[model samples]
Target: MSDSPAGQAAQKNAPHTITLLQHNALKGFLLAAAGLFLFACMDSTTKYLTTHYNVPFVVAMRYIVHFLLMVMILAPRHSAQLVYTQRTGLVVARAVVLTIASLCMGMALHRMPLAETTAINFLAPTLVALLAGSMLGEKIGGWGWAAIVTGFIGVLLIARPGGGLDAVGIMFALGAAAANATYQLLSRLLASTEKAIALLFYTALLGSIIFGIALPWFWENEAPSELEVILLLSMGVSGGLGHYLFTLAYRHAPASMLAPTTYLQLLWAGLLGWIIFDTIPDSMSLIGMAIVAASGLIIAFKSH
Candidate 1:
């Protein structure tokens, strides 16, 4: 039987309940921002290390140490289950493309200014959004197309004649963006069927294996000193910890609440570049970066 009218009135006035897994949007936003900051740290550290070490080896250290850290900590907790995935091929493809993106980004950072390089990469999300219309049959409207054009213009300004940027570095940065877009696309494709831990495991595992195979060619006979070793290890820690923080964040908030703040990494990149390397973007370059960021923001909001 239905409850009395008084009980129904009381029930209607009851407070809305939040699940243990989700509801804290403020905490989630902060965590997402922190995760993006770690990503900026990882990029800056890579650029600094590449000044003294080989690009391939430096990139390898990141993935190798990251893979090791994951094994040491995560494996004990999750055991073999950590490596299980329903979609093997898509997962590997995502990992491979991410590895490629890392390699390309490392090479670019070794040559280009951190802020500009990161700005160029900002185009990747825009590319993914625009391409989804063609690839995934998602109709991106006129605004999406406008964002696409504006994003390229921003890149062109950053790479324009006498921008004082290296042509090869600019190309490498573009390549990284392309590879990164592909990686994101594959990640989206696999999100439904794959477990997060398994996806993370394969990415780190394959990145280490692929880069480790080429390590010999770039190996230095003179071992890095103890301090240098610490820096190398820090790269991996920042990466692993960054992802961990991101995971914690999602448990408290929705993805839509967190997506826009990813652009904060570009700002963090600029500040760190100035402080760490004494590099600053020129006026035109700064404008370009702004345009790129604006374009990405538009795409993000529209999708929401």
Candidate 2:
């Protein structure tokens, strides 16, 4: 039987239920922002380390540390299960995609400023949204096309002729974005059958194993200072922790709400770039950054 009129009225009058949801959503937003900031820190540190080390070396050290940390943190709770997966091939494929994305991003940082490389990487989400129709079987409608075009225009602005941008750097950054989009799509495909920790574990483990094979060829054997070694380790730590925060945030909020917050990483990237490398975006680049962010925000809101 339905609730009595008084009970229904009482439930309607209760504000705490609404308050709780609002509180949780707010917490999600803050957590996402914090995660993005942490990731920005990771990128800044990666860029700094690349100046003293090769991209392969930096990437290998990062995943090795990440793998060790995962074993230490997750082994107690999910030792054997860490590698358990219903879709082993997809899992390995996902890892390969992310590993390639990491390599491209590292190379981009080696050639481009942190903010610009980051700006280009921001295209990942827009691509994901546009491809969702064909890839994820979700319709994007007209607004999605507009957002895609807007994002592309923003990229053109930043990568315009004689913008002092390296051709190879721009290419690498675009490659990273495309690979990252593939990674996101694979994560979605595995979301139903795979544990989040399992995916994380494999990404780090596979990256470490694959890169370890090539480490000997690229190893410079330079004795990094104490600070450099610490910084390199911090890169992996920040990456693992940042992704953890992002996962936790989604537990409290939907992806649509969190999508817009991802753009905040660009701002964090710009600030950290200036502080660490004294690199500032030019006026035109800043405008381009604003446009890219606006396009992402539009899609996020529209998706809602």
Candidate 3:
């Protein structure tokens, strides 16, 4: 009745292996949660920096740090095939659009309340739905169209053209939304064949190059304080890590399951806004945020 050596080993190690796997899964979920929180911190810091510094200078510095960080992260995972890919065109297009989105969001952050800026940016999902329908010929049903229209109305409420709108902020947020929509569409097109790391690597590389050319013109007369520089560096790290964890979460779970989790970002945004700047979004802004969130959540549920 004695067991063979191999059978004994298997029995002895199986429980430990299962425990290790469970630990790893839990670790991944915790990392994703931390990433989301850091991303909110990054947004809050960007808003703070823009209040004291020039938007272009702050933005360019942010990208430069982010680009360098991405390269360092990718060098270890090096693949020569990164430069040559079937989705090269789409990658480049996505990078250009992302660059525009970043710049516009920078402007919005500088000119508007943190929560308001974040709320306006929510329009991107709705825009993505419409863009997919028009550009990719995806079939969007009646509810999708309704959601899209409601999202736009939310945008209008925030913009409130005649009512103390910061013209630059409003325009920047709109431009960011459009670019974000384009980026999402391009991501869907490339997801099947391109490695996620490769796509992210090129996007950061190309974005750095595009922003590099313009950095000189916006260079500041005085360097940022050491503490400020540290925060700026953290911003890049936070953003890059957030995207990485988000990609990982998508692999582990379905989009529908993860979609609701993203709404946590708004709560983080609001908390950070209050803690750092003592700025609370007004009643109108909160109403707009509710509308945008409702529309996006409705679309997510409907799509499911």
Each model's TM-score? 0.84, 0.86, 0.80
RMSD of 2: 8.1
TM-score, structure 1 vs. true = 0.84
Query: Per-residue error at 84 for model 3, in Å?
Result: 4.8
How many clashes in each candidate? 0, 0, 0
Residue 177 of model 1 has an lDDT of 89
Candidate lDDT (C-alpha), each:
0.77, 0.80, 0.68
lDDT of 3 by residue, 239-294 (tens): 66666565454334333323334555777888889989898877787787778777
Compute the lDDT of residue 223 as modeled in candidate 3. Answer: 75
For residues 126-146, could you state the per-residue lDDT of candidate 2 as single tens digits? 777777668757556566678
Candidate 1 lDDT over residue span 165-224, tens digit each: 999999899999899778656654554344456777887899999999999999977789
For candidate 2, the TM-score is 0.86
Q: List the residue pairs that clash in candidate 3.
A: none
TM-score of candidate 3 to 2 decimals: 0.80
Give candidate 2 misplaced runs (Cα > 4 Å). 1-31, 247-260
- Best-to-worst lDDT order: 2, 1, 3
